[model samples]
Target: MDVIKKKHWWQSDQLKWSVIGLLGLLVGYLVVLMYVQGEYLFAIMTLILSSAGLYIFANRKTYAWRYVYPGLAGMGLFVLFPLVCTIAIAFTNYSSTNQLTFERAQQVLMDRSYQAGKTYNFGLYPTGDEWQLALTDGEMGKHYLSDAFSFGGEQKLQLKETDALPGGERANLRIITQNRLALNQITAVLPDESKVIMSSLRQFSGTRPLYTLADDGLLTNNQSGVKYRQITIAVIISRSTPTEAGVMKNSVLVIPLLSARKTLRASLPTKGSRSLFSLSSSGPWSFRSSLWC
Candidate 1:
């Protein structure tokens, strides 16, 4: 039995190094899984594997401690340190709404711009990597044409029409026939550029990555003259419901608001028998579970 155990491949120095190398690869994979999914199970498993690796190395005394120390230190630094850091961040206002510092929030709010009742319906066509914009004033029914439209300092190709304009060759010819151009055809021209921007019920025509990121972290619009300072925008969900037989019923109304503020004060509904007195605010709020019995 002793002779057979001596002949085993694992007893060889090369096989021992190969086994250690494979275990190191497994540790790397576990670390990546923990990072991507933020799963605690992966972290726990990593610690178990690391402990086993350390035990095997110390017991065998085949490899030097230098390699073993680095692997154990790396597991502690990347895997365990991040887990502790995330738990610490959970207690703080690390979410989008309360993201920036007070000074940064003020700067972002001061830079916000809005144009009232100004609408531009755009027709976009693409050739190669560039896109053409045919801008039409919806109310005036006037179209403006340019040979090229520059975005991020790059010019888009503009196609010329053979026919004369109805208004004796105004600044540009108008394609007044509504729904004349098929959406699918426009999409085919700029398969990647053609997209709908849902600001509200009205879908506007535009391309995404519309803004270029400056080295200073500011976003500059490639088309319009608007410049926006980077800020954390929070999505707030407000739900109102009635209390029935000492239990709060399902939410009857839901309102979703995107803003940079922490507290949202909305008027409660007055029609219910039991009125909503006030909402108890909690950071990462937890609701009590109710029994149906």
Candidate 2:
């Protein structure tokens, strides 16, 4: 009979420590990245999990990892991450009135300040790597200008003073007005970058503030004559004006700051399916049979 010797857990100490070291490095890297990306909640969670993993592997008696690690990873990725994100989003003012961040709003205001009161009928002419605008003001004949597309800031076009249209063909240019929504949409497309504002091809009246923020943090709605005070960064408490008595009784509506009050309605089950509560950001809640009907 051949005698067999069993190797103790200490014999594999090298392998255990190696695995723990690797895990620590990974978790540390993730925590740093998350913290820098404005995800403090995630970074804290990673730190906690990494500490637990390290402790489990470092000890000889903690066989809990065989069951703990898989569950921890699953819950961290799915349940915990989503829960953290939801909590973070709940605290932000994301409504229409305060839609843009302070930084973005500042940029937009700066860009709007540079508009000149000049309108022109222009046609788009495609160049090799750029687009040229063939513009005519009243009966002032025609002028050609080439432009570079900028993500943010003013669209400053260089007047091709000496160069005329290719073959002098005026029909090649297509007249198009600048879309204001396109400038705002760029933030949605590339949120990390500065907001872009494209100069309009036609001159128009300037924009005015519908509401202004006071030094004490009160926002006054010029149109509705209502005033809103910021209770928290995410929540604003607004008092209704005398004129809005019919639509919004003596009620309060909690709304998302990034969204417009006029454009959204939400349905919630306060009691049961038989009784449905319909709510809008701008008005009082009502109980209805069906949200659609």
Candidate 3:
């Protein structure tokens, strides 16, 4: 007869499965973030590898992976990832100035707002349970006031136009300057329907988005009314198949300081009997060529 051994409490199936599920969720979230950040290849690879890893760890029969897990992880992180990244980046049109994705480019253009109207000093005052804002310049031009509104846990405050401040109350210049960060978030609308944004510590002025994005991916300058076209060029060479004098072309975009130039370069490479790769293209643009002799 032999003595029986009991499994430790830490080795319970419930705890193990819970940890595995959490890891799966975390990996899913990271993949989503990577996809959103224009890392499509990395995100897809991470999803495939992580899902396989989690599946192997969760299943009882794959316990043999425990012996090789450390080595596999080390190789994947230090060796495989770099190699995959280099291969993936080789096919993309990624450069220092042309790094922004379409969405990020739109966001950057949208954030640029130009001051349109007069810049004025502002005030913030508390009235009962809410706050009101008052705007005026040293010239004592037409004064502006806001409705009493209470906002919670917000870093920026947008002012709603009110006919008048009930008690005509205004905070001192010291108080207004002290809450400069809160003042920075405020935007007011003018009679002409233009927006007013914080220009400085306490000054507010009318503004409009510098660039306007269109449905067809065109960007127009609000001030100059000049339209900029959005051009997309895609070249995909998924496999290196044997070709009999076939042409492969890639479009090149050379954007100068004030203009954009696109040039197309095509190469007709013939596969000889000796499996020699006679690949050549015009200009200095380079692409990876593989020969499967």
Highest-scoring model, lDDT: 3
Candidate 2 lDDT over 1-293, as tens digits, reads 99888878766768777877888888988888776554667788779877876787677688867578868877987898899878766766544544565445433433433332334445445455444544444454545444534334434344443235544333231333343443333211111221222345342222335666777867665556677654333344465333454443223324433232232222223444322223444333311122221
| Candidate 3 weakest lDDT stretch, 10 residues | 255-264
Report every candidate's CA lDDT. 0.42, 0.48, 0.59
- TM-score: model 3 vs. ground truth: 0.39
Worst 10 residues of 1 by lDDT: 251-260
Worst 10 residues of 2 by lDDT: 187-196
Ranking by TM-score: 3, 2, 1
> Taking the tens digit of each residue's C-alpha lDDT, what string does model 3 give over 1-293?
99988989898888898899899899989998776554666788788778878877788898999678768877887898889878865655455534555555557667888877678777667888778766765574566666666543334334444554446466677766776666666666554455677787667887788887778666667876655544332211222333465654322222211111222222224333212222235433433233321
Residue range 1-293, candidate 1, lDDT tens digits: 45544467657878877777787787877776664443444566566668665565646464676466777777777888789767856664456534555445444544444333335455544434543444454676655333433234222333333232222222222331322333223321222233332122222344344445467655555456455442222211222233554544322011122111232223323333112212223322322112211
Q: Cα miss at 224, model 2 (Å)?
A: 19
Candidates in order, TM-scores: namely 0.25, 0.31, 0.39
